[model samples]
Target: MTVTLKDFYADWCGPCKTQDPILEDIQEDWGDRFQVEKVNVDEEQDVANEYQVRSLPTLIVENDDGVVERFVGVTQREDIEGALESAGA
Candidate 1:
């Protein structure tokens, strides 16, 4: 199984930039077991609306089974990992 991580952020959001490294680290650590995708709220409003993202830097964790969790703002590595674990990835 694979863990799908969707990071929702706007280009103009500072926190979104701050979240880059954290996501990169997670990607590197998790490798192929996880998939990281970025969605710009402004550019991909349909996706943002579909996921019901209400704020910048929102994170949606899912697996082949579907959505597992929704996190708003910058989330820590451990938290993200915990969510992945919960998703059975």
Candidate 2:
């Protein structure tokens, strides 16, 4: 099973801009531990809706054990890393 981090964001969202780099850094730093999937809300509304992303920069962490956790808004990098660690990613 693989740990996948699904990030739902939009180009027009201000907070999403703040979140983008953090997740990018996480992807770079944790390349061996997890996978990052970016979903553009404007271009992929269906995907966002399926994940119930009502806000910008909604992050969903899932694995074979199902969804490990989720975060909305501009989440801190440490919290995300902690969640990944706890999920055994």
Candidate 3:
């Protein structure tokens, strides 16, 4: 199973900026266990709309099955790690 982390964000979103470093740390720790796809809501409105992202810094953890976890706003590292693990990353 391929676990993926879809990060919905916008350049002007403060919370999204806070979330960036957290995700970078996860990428460093997890390595190739999962893939991270960053979507700029302002540039990719269609993609954001498809996911129904109503807020900045929306994170979605998905695997082959489907979406396993979703987070809104700034999320903790541990919480994201837990979601990744659950998604078989």
Mind giving the per-residue lDDT tens digits that candidate 3 earns over 68-89? 9999989999999999999998
Error (Å) of candidate 3 at residue 86 is 0.5
lDDT against the true structure, per candidate, is 0.89, 0.88, 0.95
Q: What residue runs in model 1 are displaced by over 4 Å at the alpha carbon?
A: none
Worst 10 residues of 2 by lDDT: 79-88
Compared with the true structure, model 2 gives a TM-score of 0.91
What lDDT tens digits, residue by residue, belong to model 2 across residues 41-69?
89999998888899878999888898889
Report the number of the highest-TM-score candidate. Answer: 3
After superposition, the stretches of candidate 2 with alpha carbons farther than 4 Å from their true spots are: none
Model 3 stretches with alpha carbons more than 4 Å out? none
Deviation from native of the Cα of residue 73 in model 2, angstroms:
0.6
User: What's the best-to-worst order under TM-score?
Assistant: 3, 1, 2
lDDT at 22, model 1: 88
